[model samples]
Target: MVNSTTGNRKHFIYTLAATTLFISTYYLLLPVLPLYMQGMGGSKFKIGLIMGLFSASSLFLRPLAGQASDLKGPVKIMKWTILLYFITPFFYMTHSFVLVSIAQLFYGFTIGAFTISSATVITTSVPLEKVGQAIGIHSIALILAKGLAPTLGTLVHTVWGLYPLIAITVLFSFAALLVTWRLPEIKPASKPGDITFRQVLTYRMVWVCSLVLLSVTLTFGTIMTMLPLLALERNISQYSLFFTVNTLAVVATRLFTGRQDRLTQEALIAVSLLLIFLAVMLVSGSYSLITLIIAAIIYGLGYGAVYPALSTLVVLRTPSEIRGSAFGLFTAAFDIGVTLGSVWGGFSEYLGFKTIYFLASFSPVIGLICFVVFLHGENVWNKILMRNAAK
Candidate 1:
């Protein structure tokens, strides 16, 4: 079932540019955002609560966003989310913790809608053979933003103050909105009335995939929310460098690997999770910048490989008509992970940083087991059942 739907190349280009700009700004602010809250007299728990609540809002809204994308097409959702991106930075400038948390909540909504709709637009526009490659390309935009945003954000804050960084981010957000406004909207095959939640839920793999992704994302959450604070306490001056190195490794792996469809889906996922398992274990013991860099590289390798692989699997597993909902569900799972990880990191602080990171290492083990148990033998199970009935 290879499709020749390659004519939307220009629209694809526009989507990429728009998403990259928006995400770069968001990510640029992300590493130091918690620090901003702390400056406003917010404790780590309060900081985690704000971050968690944003993701929690995203977790709930993604399904509706996905359904909307499936019915009316991705354009409307994209427009609304980008507008949120454009407006949120103003709220961040308010210098009030409540206002900043509210802004972060808006960001959560932006993430849920944009990620699902944009991914749907990309995966559905390509041929099946190229889906994996397209996803890798789609991710490179974020990976590039991820690589540069932290170091740049941190450096900006270090040299000037937080206000200048917020100002630059707002500019990027507005630019993102402008670029996205000019793109053509492509409609899905079915009418809005025809879209239903059942369409997305019928495929059991969606559930399996989301669950596994959630578990793996827990590890990511811990790193993003906890690592900066931990490194600071340990007297590591360049914590942002850890993010820079991690993101660069992710970008390099995706670019160098080129095509990710060479191995079976499960095999690739298994290897990626195993790499993460090792990386987190390494992180738990890291005491120096060099040790963290080694851990970051390994983490990047796994993250770079697994995200696209998981996305490609979801696209292939679900039907085109309901694909937006599927992407929504998938992204929702991801948001949920980020939410819980932030809260967990905050709470785990009492457990001591080293012990907490050591505990976080086991999340991958649980995730890998879920992937194998749920996804690995359904076809064979069906065949065996059918044979027994015939006998």
Candidate 2:
């Protein structure tokens, strides 16, 4: 029993390390990729497509990956997926816009698989009661990596150029692969039986969670796809500061509120969305970098709290047998949101970036309204279940 406990601890540590490394490299690539595409003579439309392409591919592939994880075990899938990830940055070194876009498709598949697998492993390995805290800590590591990566990537790109940046990214990917090597296998609880994609599709909670994820992703997609361009158009050269401030705010808030036992998932979601709405409003009204930075900080706090809360809710709501599928569906729904936001933002260039922000600002309110109307019943039921179970 002691050996089993120690092994689980080691697995958790390794999983966290692997996830952090992978996320850091992924975030580092995100801000710079559009710039790189533009430098390679790609147009804004092309850049938007390139950005959307990753999500697009992931949207389609995630279900397959999830199914595979359940069939083949998460550890096997993670091992192969991480190796695929390790090969991705090398293609970026070719400096071909078309090739780079194709590479992003592969990148998406590998990442989507790796992420679903890791989540499956973690959910299965961690104790049910501690899942929230474990996932929160895991999220913090990923967020910290995201916060630090872009700044470091920007500096690397500025000083060392594309090839060197590619080298660095590849190195980080390799590190993630190495860390994942230590993760224990997670066997699926469900045997080869009557499970069907149609059955998973029919669950109402799945759709509810998916819609919520979509709304949040739509907001983030607008920020990711347009913020730098908006800054450039307005002659605000310190655009990276917005990212830095946003990341720092997220990191700080996650640390402070992450361990709190009293903060229910619903409460976190409600507060986070309200703050996000305010931040988006601030950003839409801002004409200067200072105001934008301030808004970014607020936005970060809101966004950071959101994922952990929503993730916990989804996992807790899902049965262990189908959790992998649920997460895959969640990921796919987010991609759909990203696709919508990117396409919408692109068209909104005719209406102006501020208009895009305005639209994005209202999306979370829609999500909040939907949750209140639809998901609150589930929350009430869950509370009743807990009360009864405790007796």
Where model 1 places Cα greater than 4 Å from the true spot, the runs are: 1-7, 256-258, 380-391
Question: What does candidate 1's lDDT look like per residue over 101-175, in tens digits?
Answer: 788888888867887887777776777678887788888887777678878988898889888999988888788
- What C-alpha lDDT does candidate 1 achieve relative to the native structure? 0.80
lDDT of each: 0.80, 0.77
Give the worst 10-residue stretch by lDDT in candidate 2: 254-263
lDDT of 2 by residue, 1-391 (tens): 1114877888877887888887677678777887787788876677877788878888899987877777778888888987877667767887787778788888878877878888777777778877777767777776677677777877888888878887877888889888887776676656665456875765556777688778888877777777777777878777778878988888777766654442476788888888888898887777789998999899999988887777777787778877788778877887788777766666544778888888788988998899778765876766766786699
Q: Residue pairs in steric clash, candidate 2? A: none
Q: Provide the TM-score for each candidate, comma-separated.
A: 0.92, 0.90
lDDT of 2 at 112: 78
